[model samples]
Target: MLVLPALFDEANKLRRLTVEVMQRLDAAGIDSALPDLPGCNESRQPLDAQSLDHWRACAMAAAAHFSATHVLTLRGGVLAAPPEMPGWNYAPVAGRQVLRSMLRARTIAAREAGREETIEALQQLGRREGVELAGWPLGAKLFAQLEDAAPQPDSAQVEIDQGTIGGGGLWLRAEPDEAPEQADTLAAAVAMGISTV
Candidate 1:
């Protein structure tokens, strides 16, 4: 299985959870890989230079490279799943919602700083010279690509929700931390879903 991570904070905050899930999967004899997408991780390619289509293509290539039979997506990572591969989604999110939240925060900050940054201007700037949105350098194509992108429709796969695992959303925590319980729960859910196949 190929483990596709969520964007930004959702991905960073769940780093420990990903590690925990991987350990559990290993114990269950379910092998998986968490490959870094192009322009992400240690890649020299600047984030703003990458288009969403490029990421999608990279995902498909990674799946092939790993010879993965299934994908395990977390949150907005659902957008990267290759259609040909079967997969499971956990807390899928729409990219548009995420972008909107980022833009809103940026707009609010600009207002307080007495800067005139409108959404349209930012969109235009992003398309022209790459703009930083919520700390991520977004290329115009990528920003436009995600504007209407929703989670890939359920494709005969499983979707797990760890909300009841307690302590609210781990991604929302002010400080970085781990949710061992949630990780275990997620691992079990993943294992169970894979077992059915």
Candidate 2:
């Protein structure tokens, strides 16, 4: 097994690089099983609300499934694992994911707050909160790619009629099938080493 931060918590405590690593391992014909920590991802609980022992249980669950495991910790602390196959903290995917999560949460908040018209709030976010406290310039580049940040999917993509300060902008048209992606932010954040600017 390979260890990393839980990426897709909505699903489970996903070892993001595991599948990719497994593919490499499989090319060499190695096998592995990755499981989620309890109260996270697919386990169906609130990780932010879970206890350390609960997290330990999660790792133990992983242990029960896999005979061997290699845990690589992101952030400063390595997620506790059973004294199994070499566990250690490597680099930081936290910065990248954290930024993306914040940005997404902010976007969602703005969209929900604005409902039909969230662009104004977003632009302000680009102005005020965009830079963050660390003096990073998280300007238009991060969210500019989004079609629009409107809440409803059935809504129009953009509302460009007249008197729009930044010229005509794209309305956030709703697409029931589409959600959001971190690839852009991941690339952008990774380029900045998880920091925003």
Q: Tell me, what's the RMSD of every candidate? A: 2.0, 16.9
lDDT of 2 by residue, 1-197 (tens): 44434333211222333344334444444454555555334666543344434455666666556654444332311333443435333332333343455456555765678854344554566544343311223433332322231112122111112132222211121221211232222222222321221
Which residue pairs does candidate 1 place in steric collision? none
TM-scores of the models, in the order given: 0.89, 0.39
- For model 1, residues 95-141, the per-residue Cα lDDT tens digits are 88777777877998889999878887887786677778778888777
Q: Which ten residues in a row have the lowest lDDT in candidate 2?
A: 169-178
Kindly report which residue stretches of model 1 are placed more than 4 angstroms away from their true locations once superposed: 127-129, 154-156, 164-167
- TM-score computed on alpha carbons, candidate 2: 0.39
Kindly provide the TM-score of model 1 when superposed on the true structure, using C-alpha atoms.
0.89
The per-prediction tally of clashing pairs is 0, 14
